[model samples]
Target: MFMRKNQIKCVSKAVLVIIILLFSNELLAQNQRVNSKSNNYFWDNVQFGGGIGLGFGSGYTDISLTPSAIYNFNEYVSLGLGAQYSYVSQKNYYNSHLYGGSLIALFNPIREIQLSAELEELRVNINPNDPSLTSEQFWNTGLFLGAGYRTANVTIGVRYNILQDDNKNVYSDAFMPFVRVYF
Candidate 1:
């Protein structure tokens, strides 16, 4: 148990160091670009994005959608909210659904880098194999923190879920990667 804790600490420290180094580089670039970019109207600072996916197979099908919008309060900070929905069905026995919302705060030191934290609340329903059983709703909360790099309008990042439960949740891991496209 002690060893696991130490490993976690090490991993956390490594991630922090990487973020710091990248952020500092971005700050330097930002300082150089500050004079070239114009500060537009508030409406111009709004961004919209989302992701959707679908999968189908002989025994299963899955679908998910997430939509979000963010308003940049300044060059350094932004706020956003989004909704998530997902459905999974197995040919005969398994069925599940998830729906939720999330709020995030982001700090951008430059155009290509952002540090963010999010809080999400979701309700999930899983049906048992037995047809007689009723579907039960399980409420879950996920708090995630991470950093992302942007290329044009797309951002890619790795996130760690702080409240994931292997036995009671649909997510497979505490760590996951994300991609977002903005308009």
Candidate 2:
């Protein structure tokens, strides 16, 4: 029998991440020639992955897309850059869109756990219905530090926003979750 629509969608998303990781891993296994006589450099060691998130509350909806690429300096160290786009809609409340980029670092003492850090800069725009309050746009910055676990292809973790904005931003919560799929 056919599964429900939402179930089918979830299955497809899972398959997509797995397929991406498997395909990239196959390419990574190649030791083919980079030149006539030269070997590949450190830049040859790279992986790509990121998380997708969606949320619903009593009167609001949140959807986001985050993609990232990481380059390995060694087994224990790597650097990455990623982008985030999110839209929030609420009944009787303002609607907003958030766009941001993050610089990420990961250090793994072992194969299973990693220490992480990110510096993010975000621009948020909100449109309110009230005539007294004008539509607003502002930039906010956050520095986050946390740890996570990594398996063969997926990572799940939580982070605390160490530098939270007090007056002009909506992400006042100090903690958040992160997921990634390594390609």
Q: Return the top candidate by TM-score.
A: 2
Every candidate's lDDT: 0.88, 0.85
Q: Candidate 2: give the clashing pairs.
A: none
Which lDDT value does model 2 have at 17? 94
lDDT digits (tens) for residues 19-132 of candidate 2: 999988877665344342233565467788777889999998999998989998899999999999999988777889999999999899999998899999989999886667
Model 2, runs deviating above 4 Å: 1-44
Off by over 4 Å in 1: 1-40
Please count the clashing residue pairs in each candidate, in the order shown.
0, 0
TM-score against native, each model: 0.72, 0.74
Q: Over the stretch 1-183, how does candidate 1's per-residue lDDT look in tens digits? A: 999999999999999999999999999999767644544455689999989989999999999999999998887898999999999998778788999999988888888997889999999998867788887788988899878997777889988898888887777898989887779
